[model samples]
Target: MTERIRHDGIVVVGAGLAGLTAALAAAPARVLVLTEAPLNAGCSSAWAQGGMAAALSPDDAPELHAADTVAAGAGLVNAAMARLLAEEGPAAVRALADLGAPFDRTESGAFAQSLEAAHGKARVARVKGDQAGRAIMEAVSVAVLAAPHVQVRTGAKLTGLLQEESGRIRGVLALIDGRPVEITARAVVLATGGVGGLYAITTTPAELKGEGLGLAALAGARIADPEFVQFHPTAIDIARDPAPLATEALRGEGAVLVNADGERFMDRYHPAGELAPRDVVARAIHAEREAGRGAFLDAREAAGKHFPDEFPTVFAACLSGGVDPRKQPIPVTPACHYHMGGIATDADGATSLPGLFAAGECASTGVHGANRLASNSLLEAAVFGARAGRAAATQNDAKGPFTAVTAAELPPVALQALREAMSRDAGVIRDAAGLTRLLDLIDALEAAHGRSAPLVAARLVAACALARRESRGGHFRADFPGRAEPVRTVVTLPALERPGLRFAAE
Candidate 1:
């Protein structure tokens, strides 16, 4: 039997920086926050090592930040949205600091910032080096727990979205303690993170398989740019399931990329060497590894003894793999990091559906068009998260007859197979043959296991990637190695259903 409940306010799915921020920002309006794991456990926000990007220095301005963001996105970034994110980013970081985020501070009481890959200035505000994500999440978790109008229900996994015949999302149907519970509310917000878990090698939590995105699409919402997935160039290759990241800040601090022959190779790929954009660096490392040279991040000269205190997270990970960063080069590989596409949303986080709002990695606000700039993930989550929260709080409760669309679950073995396939075919470098094979595999899996969320998300990535024939940003095709006219991929379930549908530029 399914249990039903009615909430007279907004329901937020996901408990990461975005969802919690939304819950916090929706002041005086009752907000119910649901998550599959305990606060800060399974979400990528807590695992973020590079911290948030914002223009905090006197010489830097939001205009510069926006320009850099647009340049890094590889021609598909929404300029207006990038401008908004940059203009509001400083305030968002400051707000988190006020909530006791404990950002690293300079002696002059200003934010201690660091330089990252594509940014023109040193503006990434970090904490205790690689502890930025954990520290900031700890502070946000504390604040959310203390908020009067926020109710957090952990161990609740979202299975379906409740929508009316008119396509209005009412709430979510989640599984709590192995029982199905339908919680209908005035509005529904999806901030369920990204689809990294779909890949065999990923830096995100294993539980994040894009259920929110699949459910939204199944319930008929517009998805944008589902093909642009950023692969981080330096995930520590220590045979871990969810690979530990060697943050880009290490390169900004003068770390170099070397091969097994101890030859610095990034200079051959790009002029900026280790400071090149993520896609270029990732491809260089991939090529090196493919050539049997085996890429490595030689940070020994950069951090050395300061590694323990400066990047405790990376230090511990290296130690776990029997490698010391102070004396040795860390083995690195490109791993699934961030998704630059998701449920299409406006600046305020409102999706095409009337009552469905999205924020964080799950929402594509045209900020991260193709490849995400280093450290901007956290900033987008904070800035747009608050916007979605406040905007959702303004909606008045609506009553309507709706149907609950529940997704099928993929078994463990099948999911592992799917993951391996994704990493092989649709990963850092993709081509028509690989993508077509991947889609065929998805079809077989869907035929066997029904249309699971992970399968849907994987299909979306593969199909769109196969359709997009040009090499641009994070998406590269060996067969078609040139850029086509810059166009955004706007898709809905109905549009995707049409046979031979090519994504037209919006």
Candidate 2:
């Protein structure tokens, strides 16, 4: 059976920093915001530890920020978007502060700044060390709930997008309280975060499995650099399934990376050592683990006295693992964290399909290319989220009387196996053999599970990873150890033909 539900104005999915920004920008445009979880619970924005990167300090400039972004991107960023984000980031940060975000400021009332992995200057504006995400989301959520024109619905999970015969996106299909329903809106924006959930050990909430990217691709939107997945180097290696993150900011504060033998090893990988780019650092840690060296973040010697106030979350996580940060190094491992690729969008967050837009970690606006620079994710979300919302609100359309489709059924056990396959094979490490094997398994699972949302997300990730042959940034290949000439690997759904699992010799 099929059911239809109609909504007026712009429809925003995900309710994170980007979604809230979109709602605020679309004010007086009458927005309907939907979230899968209670607004602040599972969204990645609230889990962000490092703060927004902007040219807020007197010694910093947007051009410097842009250059750092380009360097981290490994030569794949759109110069225009990088410039725009850098130039406009300060104003956005200021606006959030005005909305009561309570950003940490210096004694002189200037925004306090810190440096992360690839940034050249102390340009990251934070709040109380690692409380930026919680603080920012708290401020945004208050404004969103108080807004007269925004209606937010909790427990609304997106199943797919609704598109017309002409290939234009009209609205979305959602699972509201377990009942499938269709929503026709004037415009639709996807702020559904990233694909961190696809991994067995990740820093993102378990519900976000590249759903936004799959929806956009199925709707015939261009998908860019779907192979680029950023792995944060130091997730606390505890018994937790989705491991707790040890923020990169700790390294910026001089925490050292040591082996089980208490010897610092990052020095051999890069001269900057603990201060190297995330991809390099992650690989070093992975190599250590592979060699049975056992990696650990020795924060005790440096920030032990400041653990409770400086990094409460990390302190608590270490406590849960039966290790006190005040006395010992925490067991660490590289965990899948952020996705640098997603549904392709322009500077204003418009996709090729009319009435459809994307922002935040789910949209590839060329700000983060092969690898995203640390702390830039939040900046991109606020900057582009506002643009997306304003553009979507101004757009007008009447989706003809909505028609719903019967969803294909699936068997439960088959679905679990598919999730396991994706987590194991397409995870942090990859090579031609594993990817090919994973694609074959995905084909089998799709045949059994049918073309549901989860299957779609899995297939797209596997296919795109298979198609991108070179090793770059987060997409590492043991076989191909260096980056090939950089070009965005753009993909389109339904145009792909799954070749049988076989790899020719290089």
Candidate 3:
């Protein structure tokens, strides 16, 4: 059975912080929000524990926050964007608080802040220590439900983009309960999360297989800096598919990374020890684990007695996995955590494609250049998601009537193969041969099983990784051992998929 309904409302493709914020910001304009998971489930936004970074303290300032962001980004960060995010971040935090988010507060009613890695001061605003994301999302979800202009539909996954022959976005095709439905939308926002599921070990939701990024790219949107994927150094090494994160705040609180010999190893790699940039920490852990010396995070001294209260989420996850953080050293590994590259967008979250805007993890706003500063993900979502939503809401035009196509599902075997290849080739530590091998495998999979969303996204990452010949930030190439000139990588689908494309660095 086919159902056709036309409305002048905007269509928001994700239900995370960005999508929800966009929907709220659109105000009285009608919005139709679609999500594959239930409102708060399967989104990286809800799993965040480090809280949002903002210059809310009296001693802190936006300029300092922006400086730390630029430094951690490893030279590719746009100075203006960093400054914008830092300056506007406190407002976003306040807005979330006004919407009923229960952020932790001091006795004097100021935001109770905690320090995170890379930040110059105590600026990360938390909620009961580690409940910031859950609390904020819960508040936003409630606001969205009460808003008369926003209508939400869970379990509806985006399949493809509908476009006019003139190259303008017309609508979106999605899969709803095993059936295909097309919605003619005036403006579409892609807030779908990152491509962490592409890796074997990740701290992101396993269901987020880069569908949003792939769909946008397949529709011919420009992609930028696809190689920069941040690997969290302390994913709890429990036997979980998508590992649970041991928040970076632990390191800032004095947690030390020690190998099997009970040796504190990070001091030898960088002077900052446990507080170095994420990419540096991840590589250090990777090197330790690879050398047969298993790595562990001993949080016994840092917030030891207060573990349960300080970071309830981490404490619960650890106890459930049969390790108590107050005593035992928690096993840790570097896992895919965040993607710094995605469907390239402008300052206002407008993508290269007309009528399509992207925000959050799916869009590369250049706020995060190579490695993202700690706790910046939530800030970016709140700030830019509103921009994308407001921009999309202003666009009011429905495409001439057309049938919506159903999204194709990728086979399990093919999906598994692709994930393995990505973990092996385009992972935390990479080389030219591994990246090329990953590309060859992607080509083989696409040729055999057709173009799956995950494969398309994987190809973009591997292709870009192959082209970048530097060990900068999250994208560390052992073959090209040093950081060269910091020119950004911008590529189109056609350029990447060229028929005889012998991939070469730009």
Best by lDDT: 1
| Candidate 1, 125-169: lDDT as tens digits | 999889999999999999999998999998899999988889898
lDDT preference between candidates 2 and 3, better one: 3
Clashes of each: 0, 0, 0
Q: Write the per-residue lDDT of candidate 3 for residues 311-347, one digit (tens) a residue.
A: 8999998998999999999999999999999999988
RMSD of each: 0.8, 2.4, 1.5
Ranking according to TM-score, highest score first: 1, 3, 2
Write out the backbone clash pairs for model 3. Answer: none
Poorly placed runs, candidate 1 (over 4 Å): none
Model number with the top TM-score = 1
Global local distance difference test of model 3: 0.89
Q: Which residue pairs in candidate 2 have backbone atoms (N, alpha carbon, C) closer than 3 angstroms, thus clashing?
A: none
Candidate 2: list runs displaced more than 4 Å: 1-3, 399-416, 498-506
How big is the positional error of residue 354 in model 1, measured in Å on the Cα after superposition?
A: 1.1
For every model shown, what is its TM-score relative to the native structure?
Answer: 0.99, 0.95, 0.97
